[model samples]
Target: MEATPGASVATAIRLISRDKAAAASSTCGPGLASPPWAFDGAALPQYGPGASAADPAPAATPRQGALPSEYLEASDEELEARISAAKSGLGDRVVILGHFYQRDEVVRHADFVGDSFQLAQAAASRPEAEAIVFCGVHFMAETADLLSGPEQAVLLPNLAAGCSMADMADIDSVEECWEQLEAVFRGRETAGAAPVIPVTYMNSSAALKAFCGRHGGIVCTSSNAAAVLAWAFERGQRVLFFPDQHLGRNTAKAMGIPLEAMPMWNPRLPLGGNTEEQLRHSRVLLWNGFCSVHKRFTTDQITAARQQFPGVRVIVHPECPMPVVDAADESGSTDYIRKAIEAAEPGSTFAVGTEINMVRRLAAAHPEHTIFCLDPVICPCSTMYRIHPGYLAWVLEGLVRGEQHNRITVPDDVAAPARTALERMLAVRP
Candidate 1:
């Protein structure tokens, strides 16, 4: 994965960033009407760091086209019947991949259910399927599109199902941040220090993944972030992490990297709002992005859970803020949290800090163990919740009719490099 020093890296960054920024900000976005799989955060729920749901529900999709009235008005039984019929008709041609955060109604229909990376791997494993119905957020669908065969179409049930945290670090902003870093570390590699390596989380857009690939960088998921960082350090003097500050901080901190060695990069400000000296001395440059659902978890909830369920083992996602992660008994990815609960003693109690849907489902599945979400408020991923069962029925029915609706396709130019980055990730033995 080591990239030689060259001008193409800088040139590619500038060109790709401009093109992606223009496309991303283009109008007539996704949803009921608009173009298929277009990203318009306006229609998405507000649930990022420092964001509150009290704000009016942003337009959930383009106003130009509305979901067909038939889908919305269909009775639950009718919708289920239609979904079952569509699946039967399509037979093995289609594969439904669901994220753990999906509602029970939609999840029950998925042929395979798992986390983001797991779902992507599942899609890759099923080369026989001509279509992949990804029941997850926009970036996840994009990942599936990149990983699956070119002939295989990837459909996102709800085009408006976009992640707010992923939107925070657009290709343009990341490129600008990189330019600032280059200015700070001028000729450092020539002076014996290796150049900084760009590391994006799996939750980012395909364009971001391509950016990493083009720049000789690699992508990391929650489960393998520590290993990815270790890989980065061996080849580079520093790492630039994005779209989730909490995960970057927590992972680096766990690796014994001091807090002062990790500086947050604010794209809105000049020089990422950090001094030249700070950027030089930093081991990890964290982007000012965070998950809304994970941020809702607090240390107080941990205390309350402990007080109520005495000896309850508290586990949380690394996406949570540092104090919350520090207070928890263990912090890992969603799959890690699930495995811990499944492996615990039958009568053991647990308090989990993650998306509410997954937590509630776990509680329901393992009645012998007392499991509850740390956040008393039902704060599911508002964006993930956009994948209603109604949308699933509509898309499946479309497939039955030989109509391609909301298919997520990454352009070949972008997919090539993005796939390289992902392949490098898979090669890492973490």
Candidate 2:
């Protein structure tokens, strides 16, 4: 029998690891066992069982309560039927928003599926939805809540499904970094412009978004990072971009910001490990954070793909390292990759450097082309895979009984400012 997309990816990895030592030991990390709920009660920080298993989960990452045995032990068939029936019962009362990085199992049930910002916009689009079931990570759900009506509760199927990359730049650390930067720039005001502007990536926490808003800064998605940076440059002398350093660096570099002007800020270090002069001269101060999944893509992978499939077009996410982005034929956001494949001529071969789930699904959807992940390892995002059918069943069943499980609610204080930053981002045309 064929396995579900969620389970099959892991199964494929286990089988491949038997012969291919490089794949098993690759940076993308080998897959883990069944029942992701096993890690629900884990004390140590962890993303449970998936590609990000090798990536260290921050100590502050949220943990989920043990799932009830009924849902945990129920067969896949039962969970699927229950979820379907529950959605049928809920009708227009709920809108399911699935992220592109999510497993195919959960994504099949999404009323609207897209990237984080797209899903948040979807949440806002459905005014009638009493609940927004975000089949994504914690930050994504928080975003949906911020954008959705106050009456509409946003529910995350699995509480443990939190983005590791987002957690890299916590609010406290960011505030500290901000204060240190202010101290360095205190006396060197550039007439009308502020010394630095805060720009939080969409993957960051809501508090960080609010921090940006309060600081006269803005929030940016990967697709609009360049445009947002341009907006920021008009308002401030320099940009302090957080959460995903690769996105900031790549976007700035593409806009003609030199490597010397873009400095990586290690938050743990005083002055972000920069001299006062370097900080003053910096055009973009990048936070030392990255997506574990995107970091797995290497220029070596691009080289191998080009050699193996001579005419293949290579496209990667800007979140990938600068070297990998430079090596690829093209680099853009997930939506860009999807659209590229959809518009390609039949029989076009392409190598995608994003999450393996998206690449695999795109490949299966567009059978005319040969589409594959640059990394040979089966790489479903660790947090994304956490929202399997079981959690979906649990959340939907609770909703069926008029109870909101794992609801994400941002306080009015944070929501207001965060929404401002988000609206500013919306105002900028990519």
Candidate 3:
């Protein structure tokens, strides 16, 4: 990772600050001057640095307490040594799951590496382990907790690491919106007609998944959103999708649903900012939320890439806005992009629209082809960047000392139903 916004990137910023010109040229900068452990001390919580730096963290989002001084003060070399020692001591007792968006420094230490959907499935693979250390974000760890055995602990190195898209839809706001939807859809379920079905993206909180389960809804990942949408359409006349409106809208539109039939739900508005007639005519209600990261991609960027690299293949994540997806040569999940590159001809040039670290890694992995990110400015999922090597070392050392820190556990009430919705997604054949 040349200049990732992750721990190494943060460290580079800190180390180079003394050299004004060098620091100015570095990727780590004004957005991430401080390390992951040190917050800007703002009134509301923040996503440290990267794409979602400007988004306000929800009030209920987990706030990580300061890491011990030693972890912060230690050199990167020292932290790496400590993490390695702890892993050696724990052996098979602890398994670390890393998401594709994580930095190379952290990914090297992970036993399993994949996208969020793949990581969810991997969580259950090591049932014999005592702990599942998730090196992703808050929602991911919660999902791991819901899937892993009851006795197995799921720990997140940085509690503040959360998805901006996931935080956009809180349980309270969703509940309020659902009540209005019920009123709007009243009498629509008679004569064996299915009612509106809620479909939550896997990027949401476990509480939301539980909400779906209790309300006759289901969970979906970017890889399986289309399948889940199909499942919802089979049984329900209408669907309410949340978190990332781009993913919902993109997936639904791909299935030939007209833009006019899909409406946006503004939590602050009555009837989700829709007219009563529009609500009745709606086939899918997309929440007024989006991923700050993917939201940066534009049709302009695709056009620019095409002009710059004549035959460059443009592949983007579905989390991106519909226009960006439609403008590209192909659109799919993170896994899809990775696989497409892997299976491409040796001389292909790819302009990828996703996290920077992953794009850089893919480029490095297959040097025969030229690969680059659509956003030349290199913005990562700032929250994912929060899981610096220091945090991993701190948690790992605690585990070696027979202590657990930052363990994520969904309440029984939430877990039971959340599990059901997740199971429903699993039951669907992609």
Give stretches of model 2 more than 4 Å off.
Answer: 1-31
Model 1 CA lDDT for position 386: 67
Query: Please, what are the lDDT tens digits per residue for candidate 3 over residues 40-99?
Result: 355678887778887887776678887888988998799889999999999999999999
| Pairs that clash in candidate 2 | none
Using TM-score, rank the candidates from best to worst.
2, 3, 1
**Model 1, residue pairs in steric clash:** 33-65, 43-59, 43-60
Candidate 3's displacement at residue 302, Å, is: 1.1
Candidate achieving higher lDDT, 1 or 3:
3
Q: Give the TM-score of candidate 2.
A: 0.95
lDDT of each: 0.80, 0.87, 0.87
The TM-score of predicted model 3 comes to: 0.95
Per-model TM-score on C-alpha atoms:
0.87, 0.95, 0.95
